[model samples]
Target: MNVGQPKHLSRFPAKTDLTHQEFWRGLPTLQAEAVLLGPGRLEYKMLQVTGRDLLIFRSKVAPKMASTIVPHPDWVVLMVPVDWHGDYVFNGQVARPFDVFVSGGPDGYSTTGEKRHNLALGVRKSSLKEACANLSGRYIEDVALDDQQIALGAAVGTRFHRRILETIAASLEKSLGSGKFALDAVVENDLFSEIANLIMAETIEQNSVSSINLDPVRVVRRAEELFEDRTTNPPSIADLCKAANVGTTKLHLCFNEVYGVSPIAYLQAKRITQARCTYLSAEKVPPSVKDAALSFGFTHSGRFAKRYRYFFGEYPSETLNKR
Candidate 1:
């Protein structure tokens, strides 16, 4: 389990990360990889407190768009996004600011993006199961992976969000700092019991919500695979269509639904950043700007430069020359 160091707390406590990737994101224990989906330098931090039974963290990431695969597994996790000011999508669902993301029953895979001021907690699945069984006086079946809207009453959501923050604060004080924070078993039990009770009470608000349409997820995932496989020569719309096996209309709608951008626009943004990576990581040969663009299948030099500048805030030439 990778734990976070309380770096920069004295000088920049607001920016310190109490939990590194593994403690909150389930690294090494399970499979996880993150690819940045937005432009500019990534500003990421987490304020986290962990116990043997549970781990909670406040994640703050800017240029927040990301494609994450299995960040948490064998753990039931919830995310309360606080002050997520703009559009965001989780899996195939367009999430509201106050919405809670309950996942980790069967498949804990999630891809979320844009603005992510989120407070989340992960309880070991077996522990949660035992808790629910003991608390509810019966075997409990918690929610399956929620691939749909889960409406949270405004007051209830806010209250829970505050509670989570308070608990973290208290844990920090008890541990004496963020560097060596861990929840006492009693604290963990009480907090986790609340989560279990919430689930048992069916407070997650999914019954009335519509079931998620998986078509978009399938479409986008297929296209993403194509992009990954053909990075040296990014696939055309026709190629994407064939690979995804969807018509142009369905493709456009589904792509926009999942990523909030049309296929072409998302592709340009993704592929352009990749080209910059190429320039930065080039070993033997000093890759020229033109070569980088062409390697990412950008045929039109003017369009490539424009897209590069638009996404990265600098011209491709500037990046290559710097490299």
Candidate 2:
């Protein structure tokens, strides 16, 4: 096992003296401390940057008119609207609920009022680069994921991302580690990487939406159906065209326009994700990467490895070993 000490970032005890009115003044200070140094606080919880790519943040901000927050050198803020809605101006763009946007550079500000905020997970630039090396400094200033609006409560991807956010929050609250040990250190890093890659994949799609034109809703649905049926092997672009009843060219255009990556690339990523689950499960002695690649219609191991690493920031072997 890897040996390391738990990095002790600050931990705040629950404060009873904090009034709702005083929340505004304290919010920036908390965020600054966390983003700048380490963990910072708000209401009953805290925000912790676990590693290079993951951020575990849970805060309840009362209300405020306008507040400014600068970016940190290690992360780019991508807010996924959970329980509140407001105009967030980042790099001169106002992001609304159900809308995925990123603050350019390493800093930005947030403005909210009387919103019981749940969580805001920050995606690390390094983790993202590890996952999508081809992106190489691209989409650095934008949302970085698919564009089709997932209709506040219905989008599958949206729901998945939020679920991850909630899971991290829950995990942090139940953590037994004193923030300084070996086992805990490894667990924290693993969890952080998992969260980072999940968010990174989503943001990559979000930022690339302009290049894809297929209806976001439809693309999500079709992709889900395709992924659910493991037995059925279909060509990505053609299959999307067939599923959506659009011509090949239109399907390609729309899918690329809405998701940023070609439909096939997206499909490949989905397949790889499926394989990751299988490989990580204790009930199975997962297929070799080559066999998994073939099962997913990826015949070329080299190409599959490249794509798999791009989607998840690690090779299939590395991921399997983690299991």
* TM-score of each model, paired residue for residue: 0.52, 0.39
Runs in model 1 lying further than 4 Å from the true structure:
1-29, 71-73, 140-149, 174-180, 203-323
Candidate 1 lDDT over residue span 117-153, tens digit each: 6677777877776554443333336433343335666
Give the root-mean-square deviation of each candidate in angstroms.
Answer: 21.7, 14.7
Best by lDDT: 1
Across 240-268, the per-residue lDDT of candidate 2 in tens digits comes to 43455444344455566677777656766
Candidate 1 clashes between residue pairs 3 or more apart in a chain or in different chains: none
Clashes of each: 0, 23
Clash count, predicted structure 1: 0
Candidate 2: worst 10 consecutive residues by lDDT?
1-10
In order, what lDDT does every prediction score? 0.60, 0.46
